[model samples]
Target: MSIQSGQSAIEILGPEQPESAAILSAQALQLVEELAERFNVRRDELLQLRLEKQAQIDNGKLPDFLPETASIRNSDWQILGIPADLQDRRVEITGPVERKMVINALNADVKVFMADFEDSLAPAWDKVVQGQANLRDAIRREIDFTHPTTGKSYALRPDPAVLIARVRGLHLDEVHLHWQGRPIAGALVDFGLYFFHNYQQLLDNGSGPYFYVPKLQSHLEARWWAEVFAYTEERFGLQPGTIKATCLIETLPAVFEMDEILYELRNNIVGLNCGRWDYIFSYIKTLRNHSDRVLPDRQAVTMEKPFLNAYSRLLIRTCHRRGALAMGGMAAFIPAKDPAKQEWVLNKVHADKELEAKNGHDGTWVAHPGLADTAMAVMDQYIGELPNQMAISRDSDAPISAQELLEPCQGEATEAGMRANIRIAVQYIEAWISGNGCVPIYGLMEDAATAEISRASIWQWIKHGTHLDNGQLVTVQLFEKMLLEELVTVREELGEARYENGRFGEASELFRSLTSAKELTDFLTLPGYQILTQKTVA
Candidate 1:
């Protein structure tokens, strides 16, 4: 394929050696050879490793026994962090740094653990394959995901069978490979080809690695993945249909075509992942065609009907229709601070689980290990019970107070956690206008550093009391008052962190929005004050 971006994984990562990627790839193959040389009777051995790897991924037969069912109940039993279904078979992940995250997730008794290659990884190319190689070798040797906090790891390397193998390990129920939004056939195609090229035959027969496909926007894309799988399988001398796939329903366009995508990938598809952010962004960019009105906060719209909510519902229906699992996305990276931040995060986790159960998602991805307890707690609380049929309100989407949102922490929210969000919003406004890396808002990073964080907060907060379903702020007026105060605080702290640094071409527009978030808050206080403020933004 032609290089549209003028960079492949190699050039982007800036390696130590002249050809680190090539060397790494060859080294990975050599490692497989050694494993084979050690065990492969007399062949090149990659065939054997490939066969084993492929079998692990291709194996679709889930055991017949069912773990205890999770509750859909509103009360009776409750906990925090954990989701109901998660209790049966917990799901967690690991990235480049948090090597112990997997072990920790499993040690917490989680059921599924993903060794993530996307998002969390920087993919420096030269040594990019090193981790995957290390992880795969570790898995072949049967490594366990351990919990760092408790000093406890998942079940054995050789003892009782372990379900918590490193994600993409040599052996596991699924071997999910990924690609972000890059156009080189994106992550899935690129990784899938790499997998097939590298590990087609060493794979044993009964099972094979599974693929978690992402960013697919159309039925054609799903079909294309299936076709790619077919080609890869054929090239590797494997059975024509030995691969399984999960379509990540992250983008807005993909959501619209969930049914068709599922239909296209039906037999091979195993689950649907709700990608909250990118999908929301897509909605704003797409739905504008259908409306004259402007959009609101990003988070609020996730559950909004006539658009996102419809897609979410379709997701559950489509997954269940195909006897597949429906998975929820992350709770927007919540920080781990004191009890208050923890509790606030727990609430968001609860909300996700609640929505998952309500919408029929089987499980969700808990992004951080620290939040595992929150995920687990929620699961424990609901696992033994069922939702209150009577408690199921028509206004399930009804907004609640900000205090209620942070209730688990019980008034202990530090200025950081308590005012964390509003501060970030101010920082973003300042930085966006300033065209800088990050702007300090009350001693916090608000540019790209916390842009997503701020945006996510606004998205969730806006939906608190409105049918509009966006991020909630007590009031734009109250928020503005806080914003101004934070600005003063930042200037005191940074010396150079001032509104004046916001001197970009976009500053005028950004300032207008900053004024709007505040003016709107101010107007909300006026007698019968209409929301006359121009759109103030983060």
Candidate 2:
């Protein structure tokens, strides 16, 4: 199956399907083409700037608050008033935009559901296009699902949670959709397809075309999105603030420019989210060359760490100062079925959300629907009868210094943690390459962000010749040995037939190459994506 270019510059390399027809219609492709033609060059420039900034960091020029943007930070400006539907996002549940997951997430007891096309999603062509189709049906209230085995059904209940689409970051490309012989930016493809197909429907449903912009490393990247939003709004004859967005302050550099990011998108922006997993991954990647800044085991690097805490506090302070909602990070725990383990999961979630609410955050995120009630209860305890804690201006708190924001966390990297990292990364990459982005491994919902941390931590440890808790130095040979053992263990758990049929062999090779690379790879997905496309095209 194929789509004719139909005189448009964009070409669809992905196989055509009945469901993708409406999503990749000529008009929709036009919007994507125009957006790419207009903004793709700037996107390239900004991504290159990211590399240059990393080089600077590598050369001992650590990130600090920009003096030029100091005036923006010091100014007492508030973003435009958040829309009514966005005002009370006390508990937002996030998942990939699959049909059943979409229905379940919206029907959950949360206030908002972020339909993700970013980290939680592996951008295989069918999934990407079908996700847009699923969202289209969801907005129109025409979506439903039936379990193939039990014939159980799922559908949205009355007054479902508000839906916000999260587009891909700037660093990714939609290899399926090419304009002028090069792949278009994945963000534009997602934003354009979703906005073109659903904006009017969403508006008719009394909700704006909302978004969650991810992995923005600087205010300039934020500015690019602002311009795109403005162009889209005007092109469609919509009002200036008709398209609302919540930027994820998920990168190390973005923590410093929260104020400036909000300032740039003030007209259309409503809040900022603590995308903690990616932020942790960003912390390691951004400072990979700084041996002193090496992070401990992923489990040990909780939000309680001083640097992470400072980041949350600063985001809350910055967003609230400007009348924007200060959203919290994700509680990625998937509630265990075992009563005792579920108790522990809920307890952990409660403490995490409690910290966020007490820190003046207006809302928080949970990965699973089962954890919503626990998170909601905590938010209610702290912010009862309030739509949001925007009024909680933390002016009295001590100013968080740049030093605190960049402070190295202290903990041990144990052999157990190393083995866990190896297992998680290998299994996640296997799942990702097989077109499943979200997987439950060892009782937790693992996504691309967590997998990233796992692999990046290993790379950073090996790069710096760090020692494990047992006093064994981290070396490529050590990692290989553990990886081989973990694969055998995984095979035993998965059974021989399943292991042989699975992409564990490919996944293991990729993970090994990533950890053994001379330079830290930008994203595991980039390499994983190449594999996915190769398989899809074959």
- Which is the leading candidate under lDDT? 2
Task: Please provide, for model 1 over 399-472, each residue's C-alpha lDDT reduced to its tens digit, 9 standing for 90 to 100.
Answer: 32222211211112123442455545444544432222223343221223134434333332332422322323
| Candidate 2 C-alpha lDDT tens digits along 317-421 | 889889999999999999898999999999999999999999999999999999999999999999999899988989998999889999999999999999999
Q: What is the lDDT of candidate 2?
A: 0.94
**Model 1, runs deviating above 4 Å:** 1-23, 26-90, 94-108, 142-207, 288-293, 302-306, 333-335, 377-538
Top TM-score prediction, candidate number: 2
Report every candidate's CA lDDT.
0.41, 0.94
RMSD of each: 15.9, 1.0
Q: Report model 2's TM-score to 2 decimal places.
A: 0.99
